[model samples]
Target: MIVSRSPVGEIATALAANGLILRGGFNFCDDEAAPAAGSAAPAKSVLLVGQAGAAPWPHFQRWLERQSARIVNPLDTWSCEVIGAVAQEFGARAVSPSDRPYLPFQQWAMRAEGVKPSPLGILMHPQYGLWHAYRGALLFEEEVSLPEAHAANHLCDTCVERPCLKSCPVDAYSGQGFAHEACLDHVRGPRGAPCRSGGCLDRSACPYGAEYRYPADVQAFHMAAFAAL
Candidate 1:
């Protein structure tokens, strides 16, 4: 069955209904080492879908309330289902950051948004800072029109304090790299109540996108999931 191609605005509007934004997109070159979209041929383009700050939280909460059984990785499941449905509507293939044989989502984000890593390792956007997240992406057989991704002002370069590095209890993020084990231990221990109930102190220390920061309930949910790891 031939599916009619939806306009970019139509796709973006549909995703926005669920609090998802079109992060950006790029047309794949024939020689590019792009990941296949569950098809024999590589996708002609990709449109990233994500949320800025707590936009997806309410939608996620409502969906969670409707679940009859306990869900493992509820957010990821919701992302897959929502994006998958949209992809089907547009005759595109849906892919997630958590898919097995992981796609280069981080790389794609950089290419699509020109965002860079902060001292805390989260991709710091000029406006959204660490408060944004990529949920999934749609792979299209036809090249979709996209806006140019100009490099945004790097907020970290001018921030003299770099509070994110200093705020961590265990100094989980350092010049070397993230001390994952140290972070995990602290988040799971008795003294980890603050982070467990709120969010990562280091992430909270970021001054760039304070206004877009996730709500306490949303942060708490993510922290609980992190602590379970």
Candidate 2:
């Protein structure tokens, strides 16, 4: 398609139409190059693609099922396939978080979105909170014009109650840090039912983005993935 808008704008709109959103993005100046091979120069900019709510779950699930017949790692494969195709169309390169030594997506998200780490350790978006994710990105060899990142309120700052800090029965997340072993043990044990079946109590307790919370089965998928790991 002949996109009259800037490349970033075009890419963002294209992704939204495909069940994804251009959640956040950043540009790499010549001095601070992106980490990628072959070009000795990284893409001029990186654009993140992901869903912010359950609205895209059904579409993603259908896409996943269609690929189950041929791809071994469906989610990763699907991300790569969609992003790769879009990159090719836009004269860019596709990359994903699954890549080894991953692309520091969390770090990039913070910088590009002007967000900060919450008590939960993940970046707390004022709108999506803990319910969103960074799926993949596109890197262009040439600079792609993009809107400047703006300062945003760190949601946790104004959250006086901080329900996420106290909701976990096992105290899995706190200012001290996450108790990974304790969390895993609890989730796999008999008393883990609430967390295992409904998702983490702590995550659900967050006041932000309740409207964007993942559906039960979607949360169940993540819980199962964590359990499997």
Candidate 3:
């Protein structure tokens, strides 16, 4: 449990054996001014993983649930669940966009201590594009030192065509910012058929990570989650 060195490679191998791909790991400090306080003293570790399809998630969840290790948030739960539970343990409450609509959760998440959104989320990775969703986080009981945060690498910076910005028929993304209401309306209304069937047009159109694209069902599920919010 006291991993003084990089346990990422070992963890990745284990995940691969279980049919899950290790995405990355992050460290969180307890004393940092997190939205929710009272987390364990020192720092904790979170390991991220992705499955090829939806079936693997359920299997992964079952495997995680059976592990003796203390998981702050189990595989089946969302990030909100981990944040809320940790907040409660520390006698604080987690604040998210869903919980506080006016606050910018994306910006807040980026700035928060011990929180690191994967750079892949912003860039089109060789595998998963924007079609991927952060399923959940795994928390450890022990504190671990981490490296300094880095600026997110956005593929949009290098793309000449900027296909992702223009791919959407609804023009949901303006490059300056997203048109949230327009995106939601389009997904929930008649215009949603293509996106609902294939995937987010903009995300799919990204020339990066064509091979790692999320399955259609996974894409639709994530899109539905966004629409529900």
Which is the leading candidate under lDDT? 1
- Using lDDT as the measure, name the better of candidate 2 and candidate 3: 2
Tens digit per residue, CA lDDT, model 3, 1-229: 5457654555445545445554454555456532322354433554444454453555545666677876543344443554444434433333433443344334433432223332224423334445343333334445433454454555555668877777887787774577878878888888788887766887777776566676776676567666762
The total number of steric clashes, by the backbone 3 Å criterion, in model 2 comes to 0
Clashing residue pairs in candidate 2 are none
List RMSD in Å for every model shown. 2.4, 3.0, 7.8
lDDT: which is higher, 1 or 3? 1
Better of 2 and 3 by TM-score: 2
- Off by more than 4 A, model 3: 1-10, 26-31, 34-44, 51-123, 143-154
The TM-score between candidate 3 and the true structure equals 0.58
lDDT of each structure? 0.88, 0.78, 0.52
Q: Which residue pairs clash in candidate 1?
A: none
TM agreement with the true structure for every prediction: 0.95, 0.90, 0.58
**Which portions of model 1 show Cα errors greater than 4 Å?**
1-6
Please provide, for model 1 over 1-229, each residue's C-alpha lDDT reduced to its tens digit, 9 standing for 90 to 100.
Answer: 1124436898989998999999988888889977776487788889999999899888888998999999989999999999999999987899999999999998899999999888877898999989999999999877777777888788999999989989988999998999998999999998888998889999998888889999888898999887784
Is candidate 1 or 2 superior in TM-score? 1
- The order of the candidates by TM-score, greatest first, is 1, 2, 3
